[model samples]
Structures are given as C-alpha cells and as structure tokens.
Target: MYTIKYRVPESARSGQSARSEEKWYHVSILTQYTCTSTGASNKKRLHRKQYCIATTKSSQLENLRSEFGLPVVMDPIGNGNCQFAAVSYHLRQYGIHRSEETLRQEVVTFLRQTPVLGNRICGANWWTSILKQPRNNLSRMSTEYEYGDQITLQAMSQLNNMQILIVSTRNSATTLISPDGSSCLSSRYPLIILGHYPEGAGEHYVALGYKRHALERIVDKSAQVTWETDPPTSDDDLNVGGDDLSAGGDNLSAGGDDLNAGGDNLSAGGDDLSAGDDDLSAGGDDLNAGGDDLSAGGDDLNAGGDDLSAGGDDLNAGGDYLSAGGDDLSAGGDDLNAGGDDLSAGGDELSAGGDDLNAGGDDLSAGGDDLNAGGDDLSAGGDDLSAGGDDLNAGNYDLSAGGDDLNADGDDLNACDLGSPNTSDITRLREMVQFKRNRKHVHQNRHVILPREIWCIIVDIVLKLSPLSRYSLQRVNRMFRDLVGKTPPPRLYLCPSRFGDVTVSPISVRKIIALSGSGSGLVQAIRQLIRHSSWVNAWLFLRLATLCGWYTVEGIWYRRKRRN
Candidate 1:
C-alpha cells in the first residue's frame, strides 16, 4: 500500500554530526484506485516529501554530540544489566562509585520502600511476588531484572537527588527526569545522560559524559526562560497584564521627549483643532471661544500673539451667529415671524414650539427618569423580600409573600408583600450567624490546635518511611530538628548469606561492631576489613552493605545473638 525512501547524508563521515546535513525522505502511497471485473486495476499514487533527520543510532548519537557538546558515551556490556551499569558509571564521576549489582539492590530497596511509587511502576502484587524469595536472592536473580523504563529512572532520580537525561537512538526523542518528579527543568543535582539503543531483544543503556560548565549554562538559561514566561494563574491573567501595561507605560514615560513629539502631532491635528469647534458648540459659544483662545495664546504667545487674538474674536462672533441660526432652524422662528398675526390668531404654532422644547428635554432625561422609577419599585418590593426570607427560614415551607398562602388559588397578589419578621426569629438568625463564624474560626486554626504528641507521631512515621528525610525535617524548624534528633535511627540489616556462601566470619563481625561506634572509626574498620579479606568476600559483605544499604549496630548484635 505504501513505500518509503530515505536519503543518506551527502558526506557520511564517521563521528561527524549528522545535524549539519540537510536530510529528507519520500513517501509514496496508493491513495485512489479503480478496479474492473476483468482483473485489471488503475491506481493513483500520492507522493509526499518530508524534511527530517532519519531516526537511527548514528544520527541520534550525532544529535547528542551536537546538542550536548560532544558527550562521551561509555558503552556497558549488554547483559541485561546495562541500565544499572550505565547509572553506576555515571555515579563514579560524582565520587559515588558503585557496582552494578549494588546499584540494582539500592533501586530495588527504594522501590520496595515506596509502595505507592512501586505499585505504580510494576503492579500492586510486585512486592508480594518478590517476597517469596529472599531479598538478596531476588537481587541476584538475572531473570528478575526489568528493563529500565521512565518510572524506574524517575525512582532513581528521586532516590539519588540526581537528574537523568534519556536520549533514545530509535527515535529523535529525549526524556529528562528531574529529582523531584516535577516539570522543573533546573536543578543543582548532578546530571546523568544515558543513551538508549534498541536491540533485537530489548533496549540497552550507556552513560554519557559532557563538560559540566556547558550543561550548567544550558540549565541556567532554561530556568531563566521558564521563570520569565511562567504560566498564568487565575489572578495572574488580570494582575500580570495590568503590571505589564504599567511597566510598558513607565518605559514610554522614561523617553518622554520622543513620546511628546508623537503626542504633539496627534494633538495638533486631531484633538486640539477638532475639539475646539465641538466644545464651542457644546458649551455656550462665548465662554468656549474665550477658553480656547486663552489656552492657545498661553502656549504660543511669543510665536503668533496678534494672529491668535484676532482669530479668537472672529471665531467668537461666528460661533454666536451659528448658535442663533441653529435655534431659529429648530423652532421655525423665521416662519413664526413672517406669519406673526396668523400664528398668534391660531395659537397652534406657539403650542407647537412649547411641545418641541418639552420633547427635547424629555429625550435628554429619559434614562435618568427610568433609573429613579426602578429605585422606587425596589423600595416597594422590600416587604415581598421579607416574605421570601421567612420562607427560607421555615425549612421545608413553600414561599408565601406578604403572609398570603401560596397554596391558595387566588392569593398570589396578597403573598407579594409580607410585612416583617417577629423578634424571636430575628434573635435566632443572629445566633445562627454567630455559630457559623465560630465554626469557621475553629476550622481555620485546626493545624495550630494539633497536640505535640500528634506531631511527633507524624514525624516518626515520615522518618520510618524515609530515614534520609530526617535532613529535610531538620530544616523545617528548630522544634522539628530537635524532634528528629531525639528519634532513633531506622534499623538496618546485613544481606542474608546465600547457601554455601562463607563470606562474613564472627571475628570480622565483632571487629566491625567494636569499631563502628563513631563515623571515623567505622571508616577505619571497613578499610582494615577490606584490606585483609579477599576482594570478592569484602565486596559481598562490607562494600555491598555500605553502598546499597546501611550496616547497623543492631545487625551486629543480631549476628552475635544468633551465634551464641
């Protein structure tokens, strides 16, 4: 039904950015066809030309280089652990070198601890299924490993406080996961760029390294743009527009000379000249002419005083003549003068002039008279208003205005003028209003009314869910800092040894317990233990515990108790 053709780059140089070349493709489709019963068909083909870079590994790699300034892509072994390996490689740059397995364990632990996020990522039964196996065994099972998706990457981002950039080679699309799972594009967190390539089996991930300064500049610019063009909220629509207009007006006012030049041309031809004639007619002609002359003369006396004065007098006289002519035309004064005796004898023309003056005054005051009439109606409707209020207070009663029964067939007119309420009803209404005010005050200050014990319990639950969140709690307030300090640390456990594994000995356990009383002593003990033991055993027991999870004094105590 369709055929597609792609044009390769003109100069296909290895390691060169494909973005520099113009790329396009042609797609031909059979849009229409006519078929005959005689086994023959006539078809019409539609050809479409599209300008776009081909979605291939080479092109994507080139795009990454061009956009991110030649990031170094470190290919990890594609043995189903590529995602974790890539993450581990990137972490090494930040002085947080971790083995792939350790990283995987950490990811699994974090996902397990956060049930809401875990259930969303996998399924509600994900943890239940994994529970059948030992935690350590589950981490070691290669078949259990899942291909890193956006949700998993987001989990890792939140856990490590690191931002991840996933650039897909199969398509010209990139996904950036921020530390807080928000749309915020800027963060001080270390950025880890992971290149994703589609394989026959599945997708593979590789770490990408770039100049930190360039990345920082790009992030800062993006943040600046985001802040400058923030999405408008409800109030922002009116407030922001008003603020922007005020700012623009201020800027225009700052260049007052230039604005004044433009204003001078506009006022001289438009407002000043045209408005003078209109004002002269609207006002009594004499006063308007004198005002206009004085205003004009004050501004331009030195330039042309005599001409302005002469022009003012001539205009004033002409304005008075025009005013007299307008009155005569409106009232037929000339006709009345010519037929004076006849008009007086009839009395009709004199009455007609009076009627015309009355009509003009009525037309001018029509709107004001209507508004005053509406006010009078409103004042008369107040008794009906009290009847409606009484109905509302009666709970289930139907409205009956003016104490007339609404249910009565011929009582409609009587119901519209309910006079007033009694003293008891007024007192009850006041009490109801006061009760609502008291309830509102209670609800408004509910947080402040919470007991200290309740707050402590809430803090304990939070710390239990996330031990590292203690640092965040410390920054909340002095009271919270003290509470978090008083709370004991979460219990930790060493990884359960597999069957036939002989890694950790009792003597080594005692040495760790005795030395791990302080932070410095704990580091010294780990260093000495690693130095003496085989790399494999040391990695499994000490390094993995330190990297993937905490090794607690309780764990050491448990080991000692079990041996005894």
Candidate 2:
C-alpha cells in the first residue's frame, strides 16, 4: 500500500473562508501482488509520487479571462459535437452563421477531397478510417456525433482560410493555429477564438469573444510568448507546471528561491549547498590559504625577489655583491676588482694583461697589434689593411677604393660600346603613329539620302502598277522588299474578254473610278465580273449594251432625216 498527500487551499475549496490557510489531505492506493512459480509474491508499486491540483470551473474560466482577455464565453451543447458548435458560434459573430452540422459536413468534405492534408493534420489511421466506409448516410450520421480536437481545429482553419485561437482553460494559455504555420495571425482573415473548459464527465468547448482592442493586445502577447518560450512538449507531465511558472514572472528565477531550487532539488540547504558560494569557498580565504602567502606580498617576492639578503640587495653574499657599490667584486659601479687588475674595467686601462683588450675607450688590440679600433689604419703584420673607410685596400691592392673611380670607369666602358641609329626604322615608326592618329576620321559622308516617308510613297505608287512592275520593284532593295511585303496586293477585277468589245456598256470607266474612290471597288468589281463572266451572262450583257447604244443612234439619225 502507498499513501499520497495534498494540500488544498481554503480559498479553492467550497464554502471556506478565502483568507484561511491550506489544509492537508491524505489518500491511499493499493499495490497489486503477483505470484511467481516458486510461490513467492512480488509487489508492484509506483516509483515516484505525482501530485496534481484540480481547480474549479469558475476559477478556470477566470484564468481564461485574465490570460486571453476573453471575458465572455458562450457555452455550446455538449453532445460530443461541442468543438464544431463552438467554432460555428464563433463564426456567427463575424456574420458567417454556420450550424454545427454544416461545419461538420464541410470538414468531412474537405478531408475527403484533400486526403494528403487530412492524413497530415489527423493521423493516417484516422484518415484511413474516415475514408473507408459504407460511406452512406449511416456512416456520416455516425461521424456527426464524434468529438473533435486540435486536428479538427487545424482543418477548420485551413478550410475557412482563417486563424483559430484555442484559449485552453486547463493551462490558462492560448494556442494559435495559422493556415501558414506561423506565429502571427493574418489580419486579413477572421480570427475564431474558442475556449476549452474541462467538465465533470468530459471536456467541452465554448465560443469566446474579446473586447474592442483586447484582441490585438492578446494576439501580440501570444506572439511574443510563442517566440520567447520553448515549444510546449506533448507530455502532460512536462506541460503541467508551465502555466504555474509562467504566471509567476518573466523567467524561472522570478518564481522565488523556493521554486527556483526547492522545487527541483528538494534539499534543506537548497542550491546553496550544491554549487553556491559555500561549496567552492568563493566568499572566503580558503582557496588563497593566507594573505601574505603566494603572490600576496607587496613586492612580488615569488617573481622578482627584491630583498633576499640582509641589506635589501639582490643575489649578494660577500661585500655588496651585484649591487651599486663602488669598486666591488663581481658587478659594481666603477671597477670589477681592486689593485687596478680588473678583468673588465670601466675607465681607460690595460685589460687581459695587454695594452688594450677586446674594446678600449680609444683603441682595441689583440696580441699587441692595434685592430681597427679608431680613426686610424689597421695592420696585420706591417701592411696597412682597411675593411671599410674613405679608402679601402687589401694586400696593397686597391679594390673599389673611391666612388669617383667607379663612376669614371662606367662612363668609359659606355663610350666604347654603341654606335648609331637606323633611318628606316625611324620612318616606319612615324608612319605607324600617323595611321593610328587618322583612324577615327576615315568615314564616308552621304549628302543625298531620301527620307523613309518619301520612299514609302514611291513604293505605294509603284505597287498600284501592273503585277509584273510590282514584282520588279520588290527586287530593288531590302527596304523596298520589306515595304512591298507589308503592303496588301491591289484588288484585281477580271471580266470576260468579250465584254470589252461592246462599245457602250452599263458600267463606264468613270463609274469604275468613282467606285474605287469610294472604297467599294472590290465589291462592285466582283459583282460585275460575276454578272459577265459566263458565256450566257456575257452574251446577254453585250446584247443589252448594243441594243441600247443602237436605239440611241437610230433616234438621232431619224431626227436628222426628218429635218432633211
């Protein structure tokens, strides 16, 4: 048997004083025992104790109000269709009044049409089960009673092209599902806010409404919260204390020292004992040992030990060794040793038992021979040798002794080397330079080029001539070819050759010219050609024209005869 304890606040309990302290309650749970083959019993028990706080529905509603700024919650019918009912009621506020049954049917239809999206939003098994059916009226009617969840809300958001904010009363937090999977809510689309409240028997959803500017403030807060916090986990245990901690302050530390360390550590000394100031001795002198030890002294004795001896000196044993003493032994101010037999004396003196050693104030000598120590000659066994000076010589031979000698020798060598220039090369170079200078000016200037409009007019006149002439004109130039190609061919009127033999005719040349000028020449020509093209029509036309002409002539001749 195991026992668990809970402390319920007096304000949270019914019919209790609001200012009263909390009271503890105990509950017991029995463990199951299984018998093994050896006749021994093993007891199965829970490893860790889990505590939960249950709030009243009114308190939960108040939390939803404070967090989401939704003071009004319209409860829907809890007939397993509360999700759709809540969504329908929310849409009704925006003048899109849809019934719960209509929204359910729309969701089903959307899922059926887009199976891929349905499978992604809802699980594959759920989608496959929805697809499989005697999908008749009976299956659909059965689905109408099925409860909806976040999957249904996602489908509704995508189907209606809107955003859904699920203000959960359990956690006092808002969950925003956008069509584009972003943290922001698109202002162009309507926002549907739904409240999820826990009921005694089951969970129910209600439509929530906000005040005038409360919606914008809540949305901005939600976006800020979404970015500032880690994504909530799926486990109920992990999400349990999130609301409690977030409601406290901006960070975990703001929950006070109790929740900061006691909640997770559960020790008496808290985090102070584990890794605080006391554990590492960071607040005291334990690590440093003492003040005067290990680099604590004023003169940095470990690095630069100033006074290792009695007289505030350095590395000295006898008479002020390695100090600023005059005429001291090893390293002193004036002399290296007494008796003037110093190994390295400061002033001018003999050294290494010679007149001068390595380098004297005035001269330097090795083996009683003066080296190049001053402004004088250096000799090795009687010969004056100079390595570098105004004059330099080696073994009585001058080698680049003077700067003027080098310059004069170079000038004489140049005078003996070269002769003259080539005249033909000079002439060719001058010609090349002149050709490059005149290249930009080499272009022909034409003074007589006709304008494009004049050329177009001339081409138009030529096109009105015979077909053979138009064809010959097209072969003139590229411009003429293009212009003739662009211009439409002149209308041709063909009539019977016999029609031309008739001297007088119904249609005269002046009539044809008048029709062409009126832009109906094509129609009139076609009509006349059709009238006189066949043999019968041509013969009839000819007979008519000749009879008319002959009658007129006879009338004139008869009048003349009568007068005579």
List the pairs of residues colliding in candidate 2: none
State TM-scores per candidate. 0.25, 0.26
The whole-model lDDT of each prediction reads 0.41, 0.42
Residue 479, model 2: Cα distance from true site in angstroms: 85
Model 1, stretches more than 4 Å misplaced? 1-70, 118-146, 170-172, 198-202, 211-564
Q: Candidate 2 on 267-351: residue-level lDDT in tens?
A: 2210111221222222222223212222222221211223322233354433346432332334333233332322232334333
Clashing pairs in 1: 401-415, 402-417, 402-418
The CA lDDT at 140 in model 2 is 53
Q: Where's the lowest-lDDT run of ten residues in candidate 1?
A: 374-383
Error of 2 at 294 (Å): 88
Task: Give the runs in model 2 whose Cα sits over 4 Å from its true position.
Answer: 1-68, 118-142, 171-173, 198-202, 212-564
